[model samples]
Target: MHLSHPTPLQNIMESKTCSRRGILLPFNSYSSHKKDAQHCIFCDTTFPLRNFKGKAVCPTCSQNILKLFLEREVR
Candidate 1:
């Protein structure tokens, strides 16, 4: 089908990593029905939701995010 512009795959659906976003992150998406685990926002690292308070971000991603925030704060 012909179209003026096509939308990105990630922006078409809700992201599984974040709270709310019209983004479909395939790499971070899991087909399993296990509700105890989740994938990280930046990377596909599996983590427990209970420990992270429902946040799907892993330690590596968290550290990177922290570093970025600290750098921005420093600047």
Candidate 2:
């Protein structure tokens, strides 16, 4: 039997390295899961609960919650 030519995915998979997006997809998925599954990392009391663009405001405080989030997690 004859083999088919390699597809783009086959090329990526056969290579020793992953593309930038491929390398980061798991990180993005994890971030998305964390962003979706938990409350605002700032106040730690309000869940985003609705939006998937990955944004939400704390119900009790006006703050750049995403900034607070990354700061908290990096420690």
Candidate 3:
């Protein structure tokens, strides 16, 4: 009996086609813009800002603010 391993070329091609999860898509539809990077108001972490919206806080803090608002509404 004989076993055959993939060649270096095959390995490279496979890596380019797939990620840690599954096959790579032709185009990344969810890709976000990288030009508007800014620091989060609350945590001060740098992240990409979205669209034309002016947000001082990052998404995490925004979600937290929403949660707080919902909690206050339920009370």
lDDT of each: 0.62, 0.56, 0.65
Q: Which pairs of residues collide in candidate 1? A: none
Q: Candidates sorted by lDDT, descending order?
A: 3, 1, 2
Candidate 3 lDDT, 1-75, residue by residue in tens: 544988889899998898676666686344353455567665676764332246566667676876756877999
Tens digits of lDDT, candidate 2, 1-75: 655898788897877475454433334555666655656434556553434356544554344556666877999
C-alpha RMSD (angstroms) for model 2: 13.4
Q: What TM-score quantifies how close candidate 2 is to the native fold?
A: 0.22
The C-alpha RMSD of each candidate to the native structure, in angstroms, is 15.7, 13.4, 10.6
Q: How far is candidate 1 from the true structure (C-alpha RMSD, Å)?
A: 15.7
Worst 10 residues of 1 by lDDT: 47-56
Q: Is candidate 1 or candidate 2 better by TM-score?
A: 1
> What pairs collide in candidate 3?
none
The 10-residue segment of model 2 with minimum total lDDT is 18-27
Candidate 1's residue-wise lDDT over 1-75, tens digit each? 776665676555534445864766566445565675567755677763223445677777675877756877898
- How close is every model to the real structure, measured as TM-score? 0.31, 0.22, 0.29
Q: List candidate 2 stretches off by more than 4 Å.
A: 1-36, 47-54, 63-75
